[model samples]
Target: MESSAETELGRRVASFRELGGLSLRALAAAAGVSSSFLSQLENGHTNASVASLRKIAAALGVTPAQLLDDTSVHTRGVLRAADRPSLPLEGAEKYVLSLPPLRNLEVYAGRFEPGGSTGSEAYVHGNSQELFLVTSGEVVFQLAEERYTMRADDSIEFLSSVPHRVLNTSDAPASVVWINSPPTPNESPHAPA
Candidate 1:
């Protein structure tokens, strides 16, 4: 195919692709584009449609704006609620803190709905330490073989390696803030490429 008019998009694509640690074939498969086509885009021999760019961004777990925006610089350290990312757990929503990625600690605010449970199965988090504070409502927390019925302003700190989980026993919503050191295994980055 013929090359597109001069543009710096190819450079950006290559840069982000490398940062995402994806091989040409892997990225192509994820982006739903042929390997040869991705090669053309990377080599500045072709242009990509908006759809293609969006797909690539999703596959890389980023927004298309992040890929297209030239103003990538942003302030760190202080995180606003609007920018804080959240993850969905089995029966709760967890707002992730804005700590440095390399930091050994992780912080999250969890909101649990009525009758919500953290799943039937108890899970472990290696040997990391965890602290959970109930901001509102009541909950049933089980750590290893022990169970505790807690209410607002209640908090607990324990080893994450224990098989534990929580259930919101109240009719209203329950909220908790969690802090963990040496983040859980599943939360870590994908094994350093």
Candidate 2:
């Protein structure tokens, strides 16, 4: 018997595939899954393995976690830290604290060890803005040519268009709470910076 989670996942897969205007055979080919298997998955008659699911998510231009995100809970709700969704980005771990795919905001908690970094290359988000508060230790933020060292309890805001990267500089682990308003959906949420 198919679990409710599998049914919901299958529904979301079909919905996203339809939204992308992809036929069952086309998506199956792109995801490297058999058309019959894809059909079964879409019909909630079968469940996909993690590897297959990741392939499907990649073909849809999303991460596996994105496919798992429960977007149906869009109304107001509270998420405890233990139940938050997490993604590994660069050398840090990012825990999503806010309901995603929404137009309003994205809240995330990032934890990093010494020498850990958001990414090797800087990236731009275009027309977005972010505010982050240092919760513990220190973080080195590089925006273009300027570098800002943020310590515990420090907060900063900057435009997303400016290419930037975050790095942990302290010997101890560092943590921060990030708030990005008007989230960018084009980029992979699993990526850091």
Candidate 3:
């Protein structure tokens, strides 16, 4: 039997895809997933990873939180910290600070544990410009071939299309804020060069 969470996720995906007037195959192609896999996902026959959900959300032009939430009540101006949706990945955590119906802007809070990193590989996404700010501790950012170590209150702006990654080598946890204009789209980290 499919878990309720899985069923709800599938339903949300299907709903958003339909609302966008996208065909199953079209959304699948845009999300870089096989049509059969998308079909299975929507049918609740299988589960999707956070990465896959992110891709689908991007393809739909909505935040992943929008897909996860049952209602948009929290999107009406302010989103409380307690109500914030978070994605906890391997050694790293991310919290969405922007609400749904995001026009050309999106904001996120990132937390990295000691020795944590975004991933071993760098990634590119969409055409939006991005601004990253280190709120606490320290983080190392690798944008293309250049690397920069950023401390608290440090920030940098760059194009989202550039391959980038973050690492926290300190013994303490690091916090960061990311602001992206023209929300990022469905481009997987492992996308072909």
Number of the top lDDT candidate:
3
Q: Mark the regions of model 1 whose C-alpha exceeds 4 Å error after superposition.
A: 1-75, 189-193
lDDT (tens digit, per residue) of candidate 1 on 113-184: 987777777777667788888888888888999999988899999998788888887789998877777676
Instruction: Report how far off residue 177 is in candidate 1 (Å).
Output: 1.0
Error of 1 at 10 (Å): 30
Model 2 scores a TM of: 0.57
Stretches off by above 4 angstroms in model 2 are 1-75
lDDT of 1: 0.72
Tens digit per residue, CA lDDT, model 3, 1-193: 8888888878888887776557899899999999999998888888988999899889987788888886742233356787777776558887887654355567888899998877888987786889999999998999999999999999999998899999998899999988988766553222211
* Candidates 2 and 3, the one with greater lDDT: 3
Candidate 3, pairs of clashing residues: 104-182
lDDT (tens digit, per residue) of candidate 2 on 87-157: 87667888877653344676789998888877787777755778878999999988889889999999889
What overall lDDT, based on C-alpha atoms, would model 3 receive against the true structure? 0.80
Clashes of 3: 1
| Alpha carbon RMSD to native, model 1 | 7.7
Instruction: Let me know the TM-score candidate 1 reaches against the reference structure.
Output: 0.55
Worst 10 residues of 2 by lDDT: 70-79
lDDT of 2: 0.78
